[model samples]
Target: MHMIENGNVAAALGVRRCRVNVIAAYPITPQTPLTERLSEYVEAGEMKAEYIPVESEHSALAVCIAASSAGSRVFTATSANGLLYMHEQVQWASGARLPIVMCVVNRAVGAPWNVWNDQQDSISQRDTGWIQIYCSDHQQIIDTVIKAYWIAEKVSIPIMVCYDGYILSHTYMPFDLPDQDKVDAFLPPFKPDYALNPDEPASLNTVTLPDVRVDVRGELAHGYMEIRYLLQEELRKTLAVAAEAEKRFGDIFGREGDPYLESYRTSDADYIAVGLGSLTYQLRVSVDALRKEGIKVGILGVRFYRPFPDEAVASALKGKKAVIVFEKALSYGYEGALASDLKSALYEHLAGTGALPAVQNYILGIGGREIHTDHLTQALRAAIQGSISKEPVWIGLKL
Candidate 1:
């Protein structure tokens, strides 16, 4: 049954129809709509799932850990402080290697208690052993929510589907709803390899000493590295598995999926702007206007953040005059995280091939501030004119 709704409702219905066995949720701003929708689904018998309305975000994630430990397909959603509240369990979910999929609306954590757009909370857990996927639009959010299950289960890790607080989360957009049969075919039932079965009862998330540890820590660290490696490797794979999944999605539902990154008029440009999430969509509009004015500027919308598509990024940016990286979060005392990673990607290539372009980092759009077209237009013009200096630059601010 297809319906017109916001991204949050669409996501809730997608997971509900996927037949999730356990849902642990505590409502928070921007993400409450999803859980609210899931509640209605359960109440109306549209979904057959156990919806646990928790007292707090911490308890929500705790419930997820318990359900997942019992080998149920568990899911949750939160934003900002809610994610921060579940901080401990975030690591627990990954350390235990539970394929729990979460939707974290990118909101700013605050001393002033602001519930608006920002990337800090989710990005703060980058090292928590979860595969993070960013969505540029509502369609990507719905599609990635399904893809996240396959990716997480295949690699046996958690996945966080992040979208800007207001941009995609609150904005209403028309998106394709894949047929249930196609989704069922594409995403195999999430049968975990390890679980707490009564026939074969086992301890989970146990503490251990450094030397006397049961290799859980060692295996966890290794599993994290391997999962990340495979996640990147899967992006490079050109076989039927990934492609067939995307093709089946397209054939049944008519939604297209790109392998890694999306390019916009970069074929003959000397400069490129790299960004992720909804900002990239706005940047595309800015690029088009600049191009019309005879400005040779283009954009590369980064879809995958954690794996860091170094080779793909290098190939697209190679021979370009300069590359400008726009990031929503700051690493604190360092440049933007994406900018640093982009430089590192180029550095690896530079070491092997001895060729790379001048790159600069621009930090912008944190704490729910506005990012206008002129901001990008001026930044790109400065980058093209060689007026921008310093390794780390802050964009659209008095500084």
Candidate 2:
């Protein structure tokens, strides 16, 4: 069962020189191999780092938070329900502004017991204030990890490099591994804007009332609004920060990826299929097939999720006839989250500029259901052929 080109192993080795000084994780299906491989590399002396095997997912994140607070670059991996269990600490990591990088193998949350790919577990936490980057393939899985540190440390926020469980995580493909010297030159030691220093000795995570609090210079300020504004401004700047990181990564690696969104064949197409994660790969293949049949269909693959790339999406879908948002998770009572967010992003463009393209959302994959080429192709063809509604459309339903 040993595969020479497994994506998880390739990604682990690809970012091996990031110098992860600490790792704290608990084993979970589909994501277990990722941490396991890191442990192997550490034991084999490939990476000089401290590996902390924790008892539960909650403690896994707790350990990372402690290490990062002390100013050490940390790493971890988890999937499905494990990520759900770390939900509380997930917010704490971002609120404390520790730039830790973790690999999220996107999987379905279970009650009936399932181990499969779905974005629901992570997608539901879209408001966690961490930079969420979704990957389409194994190559991206590795490349994004290194870029994540650059982006996170630059903006002082955490990042989750998410890949579809089993799809990109377990698949095998040949990929390039960066040299250690180049990586060292690219990423330096962790220098936080602030850290938990014993000598400095400041209050960490102190609660605030509506009244007052002391600032660093002993000035009075509204702690709640001040911290909230700081978090918001820093989050808004993550888009540009990630873009700059991608530019630097490209300069060294000779491959450029837009941190927000990537458009394909949109300049001349009439319809665009907006997709994320592994589903974009299938959507691209189907779009090619649809093109061979003389249909003009393009693809817009969403890479960044948290800081939604409104401008990039608006630019790509400006002159299109219609846009079909292929969503992997539903927003429960509000239709597809990506679809609703995209609609909001395009409203200004439609009002300011010329007529914007028609937008329709389709919930395709949920609860670990399979999404194939025929399902995507047929739905796209239907939308292009007739008048599709602006509301969210559910694809591949059997009822």
Candidate 3:
């Protein structure tokens, strides 16, 4: 069915279609409406699920952890400080290898008390051992949420289906909602290898020692470090799993998916603009405008952030002259994290032959500050013309 609705509702419809058994919902700006729609579905008896209204984002995720541990398909949503509040459980959920999916409506964290759009919140949680897939629009929001569940269950790792707050969450756009029967066929019932049950009465995730130990059955068990290694290995392998899942999704839904990143006109371009979420799509205008003046520029929108697609990135940007990265967040004392990561990938894979591209970082749109296409175009032009700097470029600064 074709429909025009906000991103939150699109996400909610995706969750409902997947038949999530439990939703740990707490209201937070931008993310609040997603849960609000879930509540409406549960209240109207249109959706069959347990909608647990919690007092805090921490408790909301805690409920999801418990429900997911017991082998229920679970979901939760939050923004900015709300996500920071769940930091402890966030690591625990990933470490425990629970297949829980969450929607993080990207927002700026505050010391000055701002509630606006930025990638800082989720990007800061990069080391928390979760698969973070960023969406660029409402259609991608709905489609990615559906695939995240399958990928999480396949890898025994948690996943975050993230999109920008207000930009996509509050805005309405037309998208094709997949048929319920098709979604059901694509996502089967999740059956965990282990689930909490009265009959089983097994204790999971207990305190562990640094060294390997023998269990009650006299078999050697993994130590703390060894367990962490397995988690890292599975996340790396999830790249292939995600690709296969998306392939199956395309076969059924008729929309081919970009497994790691989406490239727009980078085939013969010498300069490529890279970014995440909806802002990257907005930069498409800059690419076109610059092309009119004989500047061959393209856009590279990163989709899967974690388990960073270094190989695919290196492949696309191998012969480029300059790679300009526009980010909504930074590394505190240094340039944008995405820019740094991109340079590392290019250097590690292609530096020996001297084919490395000049990577530039530009930080903008912090705390929902307006980002103009002309500002983006000017930045690209400056970087392409060798008028760049060592420090990260801060676009739209009046001071």
* TM-score for each model: 0.89, 0.95, 0.99
> For residues 304-391, what per-residue lDDT tens digits would candidate 2 score against the true structure?
9888888777877887789889987888888888888888888966657765777778887776678878888988998898757766
Against the unseen true structure, what C-alpha lDDT does each candidate score? 0.79, 0.84, 0.93
lDDT: which candidate is best?
3
Q: Which 10-residue window in model 2 sums to the lowest lDDT?
A: 1-10
**lDDT of model number 1:** 0.79
Model 3 ranges off by over 4 Å: none
lDDT for each residue of candidate 1 in 1-399, tens digit (9 for 90 to 100): 455678787788678656788898999999989899898888898888899989988899889889988878889999999999999989787777778899988998876798888788888888776767788887788888887777767666778988888788878888777778878877778777877889986777554434332363454333344544554455344222434556666676667666457788999998899987888888987888889989888888877776566788888888788998888887888877788888888887765564677887888887877888899888888888886667677776775
Sliding window of 10 residues with minimal summed lDDT for model 1:
234-243
If the candidates were sorted by their lDDT against the true structure, best first, what order would they fall in? 3, 2, 1
Off by over 4 Å in 2: 1-4, 215-217, 352-354
Best prediction by TM-score = 3
